[model samples]
Target: MAKLIKNSFSADLVRQAKFFKALSHPARLSILQYLAETKTCITGDIADELPLSRTTVNQHLKELKEVGLIVGTVEGVKTNYCLNTQAIKDFKSSAISFLEDLNIDTINCKK
Candidate 1:
């Protein structure tokens, strides 16, 4: 067994990593795009919009939900899903800061 080193990073970095991981999948991206386009809580089958199966879509939704990107509420037999605005805002801020930090005027290469 190896020791976990994830705790060594800052909380913000960890959170940003989680957000990036959740968005890394195309299915998850599509889900977010679909929700954003709908602009309302979706109680219907979200998988209908994607090429993947219901089970696969649900898994992607779980990842997004776990990362605080999406909220899923149990409404009777259906789950109402929507984007978590605050989390998205926070993610945007953190991601911009992180990306801006890497924005340099030039990069030096050594042979």
Candidate 2:
């Protein structure tokens, strides 16, 4: 069996990676946009608003929920889904900090 390599990156980097990975898919991004636009917890039939099938939509929602980008609450036979504002704020800070640390100057470009 091959040996598993240890992750040497910082905790923040790991978290940022998870967020990026979760947002990498278009379906997940669309779900977030829908939640934000609705501005309220949605229950039942979210797939109707998207181009994807119910199963596909659920999988995308699962990924977002896993990353704390959205939250879902079970109500009777349905589940209500909404954006996790705190998590979104935290992710925004993490992403901003990472990009700012790069300190790229547009003035120093190749000819």
**Pick by lDDT: which candidate is best?**
2
For model 2, how does the per-residue alpha-carbon lDDT over 1-111 read when each residue is reduced to its tens digit? 123336766677778899999999999999999999999999987999999999999999999999999999999999999999999999999899889878886558878
Listed in order, each prediction's TM-score against the native is: 0.88, 0.90
| Native-to-model Cα distance after best TM-score fit, residue 40 in candidate 2, in Å | 0.6
Cα lDDT tens digits for candidate 1, 1-111: 223356776776777788999999888899999999999989978988889999999999999999999999999999999999999998999899898888565767676
Q: What is the C-alpha lDDT of each candidate?
A: 0.89, 0.91
Model 1 misplacement above 4 A = 1-6
Off by over 4 Å in 2: 1-6, 106-111
